[model samples]
Target: MEGMNGRSVRGVEGYTRWSLISLAVGEPVLLWLLLHTLHDGGSALAGPGVAVLAVLVLAHTAACIHAMIAALRRVDPDRGRRGLLPLAATTAAVLVAVVVVLPLDGPAEPVLASIPRASAVAVIGLATIGALSARWPMRILAALTVVVLALVTLTQLGSRIGGIIYLLPAYALVLVSMIASFRLTVWLLEVVRELEVSRESHASLAVAEERLRIARDIHDVVGRGLSVVAVKSELAATLASRGDERAEREMREVRQVAQDSLEQVRTLVSGYRATDLGTELAGARAVLDATGIRVTVTGSADGASPAAQDALGAVVREAVTNVVRHARATWCTLELGAPGGRGAPGVEDGEWCLVVANDGSRGDGAGPGTGVDAVVPGNGLRGLAERLTPLGGTLTTTRSDGVFTLTASVPSRETA
Candidate 1:
C-alpha cells in the first residue's frame, strides 16, 4: 500500500532494480571475456576474443530486454515511463564493458560456466514472457554477490593489493545497495505523481457532491412553499380585480400563507438557499402582495436551461428580498430587463436583465427585515452576488426618490 517515505509501492519497480544489477555485473563479464580471449600468451583481439565479445554482450543484451519489458509496464501520473528501450540499451552497453576491461586469462574456459546452466535458460525464458517478481532484489543480490565475490577472492594475480578475499562480499553488498537505491528513488517519484492525481480527483468530486446536496435542500424548502403561495396569490388577485369583499378575507389568508412561507424560507436561509430567479420571484411576489405592496415584474426569459434560469432567478429573488426587507416600499417593480435598455447603451435588446425597484412607505415596518436576529450574514443577498459574479454579470443597488432599486445585468449566453 505505502512505503517508508509515504510513497505508494509499485510492484514492478523491483524489475527496474534487477536491470541495474545486470549492469553492475557487466564488469565480471568483461573479466571473463578477456580471460577467454588470446591464442596462447601474446596480446591479440582477433581469434577467440571475437567469440568472447558476443557472449559478454549477450548478457547485457538480456538485461536490455528485461529493462524494455519493465519500462512498458509503467503507468504515469505525471511523467510516463512508456518505453523501456533506452534502459535496455543502457544495460546492453554493460556487455561491451565485459569486452573492454576484462583481463586476458587466456582462452574462454570454465569462468561463467559454473552458473546453473538449467536456470540460465529459465531466467531467459521468464524475461521473454514479461514475468516479474517481488523477491527479485533478494534473488539478484544473492546470486550476483556470490559470483562477484568468487571472482575477486580467487583471482588476485599481479595487483598492488594482493589478497582481499573477505572484502569482496562487502563491496558486492554495497554495489547492490547503491544500484537498488537509485532505482527505488525513480519508482518513488512515479508513485508520488500518481497520488497527486488521485487527490485532485477526490477534491473535485467533493465539490460536485456538495453542489448537488445544496440543490436538493433548496428545492425541498422553496419548491413546496412557492407552489402554494402562487395558487393563493393568483386567487387573491382574481378576486380583487372582480371587486369582491370576500377577496379581503382570502387576502388575509394569503398573508398568513406568505408569512408561513417566509418563516420557512428564513429557516432555510440560515442553512442554505438554492434560490433561483423563478422561485425568488414567486416568493417575492407572494411576500410583497400580502403586505399590500403592488409588485410589477418584466423581461424574464421564458424558456432556458434549468441552470441559466436558476442563476437568473437568484438575481430577482435577492433584489426583491432586499427591497421588501430593507426598502420599506409600498410598491415594488421587478424588471428582468434587456441589456442596453436604459442604463447600458451599447448592448443588444434581448440581453435579459433584472431590475427590482420599490417605492418606500412612511415608516413601513410592515415586513420582517433581513435576518439581523440570527446574526448570520444572510445568504439571501450575498448568495445572489456570488452566483452572478462567475457569469461576468453586474449587480448594482441604489436609492432614488423614495424608492430603492437593485438592478442586475445578465448578458445573454451568446455574449456572456
Candidate 2:
C-alpha cells in the first residue's frame, strides 16, 4: 500500500511536469503556424527564416521548461529560493532571441510577422518562470502581462494599431492561463507530499501514544510498591544495627512487599499480553474500513471465557493484519460463536469458534496444510497455533476460489 501510494504521487508529479512542458512547447509552435498561415498564405515550413526562428523559440522554451521543472521540484516553502540562475539565463536568452530577429533588413510586414511568434514565446517563458519564482499568482500574471505588452508594443511601434490591440489581449490571456496552470500544479504536488508526510507522522504519534500508555501502566503498578520496599528495607537495616529484636520481622515484611510488587508486575505484563475480543473486533473494523475494506462482524464475545476470548482476539488481530498487509481483500467477515453447522467432525458442542474469511487471497500461503505461516513464517500463524494449542484450541486455514479462511475453536467452558 505504501509503495502504491508513493508511485501514485510520483506519477502525478511526472504527468504534471511533462504536461506543462508540452503546453509550453506546443502552444508557441501552434500559434506561430496559425499566424503564419493567416498573415501570408504560404506554408510555415517554406522559409529558412521561419525554421531558424522556430529552433530559437524551441530552445528558449526548453530552457524555460527546465527551469520551471527544477523550481517545482523544490516545493518546500521553507527552503531557500532555487532555480533562479536558470530562470535568469532563460529570460536573458529570450531577450537575445528577440534582438537577433530585430535587425533583419526586411519590409515592415516581415518584421511585424515575426513579432507575434517572439511575443508568444516570451510571454510563455516569462509567465512560467514568474509562476515558479513569485509568491503570488496574481502578481506574476500582472507583471508578466505588463512586460509582454510593452515588448510587443515596442517591437510593433511603426506597425498597425489594430495589430497591437489584437496581440495585447492574446498575450494577456496566455499569461493569465500559464500562471494559473503552473501555480495550481505546484499547489497540487505540495498537497500530495504533505499528505504523505502527515500519514508518517500519524503512525509515529500512535506508536508514541502506546509507549506512553505502557509507561503509565508500569508506573502505576510498581511506583508505590517499590518506594514502600525501599523505606522498609532501610528501617530493617537501622533496626539490625541498633540490636533491635524487630529487625528480623522488618526484613521479612520487606521481602513480602518486594514479592507482592513482583507479582503485581507479572499481572500487569499478563494484561498486556491478553487482548480483549470486543476491543480487537472494533479496532479491526475501524482499520479495515479506513482502508476501503468492508468488514462484517457477527455474534459476540459474551459467551466465551476470558482465555478463549483472548486467544480468539489474538487470532483476529493476526488475521486482520494479514488482510491489510497482504491479502488485498475487499471484504472480510469475522464470526464468533459456537461452531454450529460449520463445525468439523471432531469438534464437540459447547465450543467457541472464530471464523475469519476474506476474498482476494494471494494464494502463496493458502495451499493444503499451508497458512499465513507460509506467507509470513515463524511468528505468524505458527505462533498463533502455539498459543491456542495449550488451551485445547485448534487453528486451521483453507483457501479456495480466491478466498482464504482461518478457523479457531476452543472450549468456552474452560476457566481462565
TM-score of each: 0.33, 0.71
Candidate 1 lDDT over residue span 1-416, tens digit each:
22111112233455455554454355445444443443333445454545565554465455544544454344432122323444345334543443353442333233332221211222222232121221234475456545545544434334322224333444555555654665465566466546646655755886899899878877887787778778878888899899987788877887887788788778877545443556667767765664446777665555544445667776665666666566556578876654445543332465566776676623323334531121123566567777767765666555434455565655566333
Scored by TM-score, the top model is 2
Candidate 1 colliding pairs: 30-98, 30-102, 35-105, 36-107, 36-108, 276-313, 276-314, 277-313, 277-314, 337-353
Looking at model 1, residue 205 earns an lDDT score of: 86
Error of 1 at 164 (Å): 7.6
Superposed Cα deviation of residue 159, candidate 1 (Å): 13
Predicted structure 1, TM vs. truth: 0.33
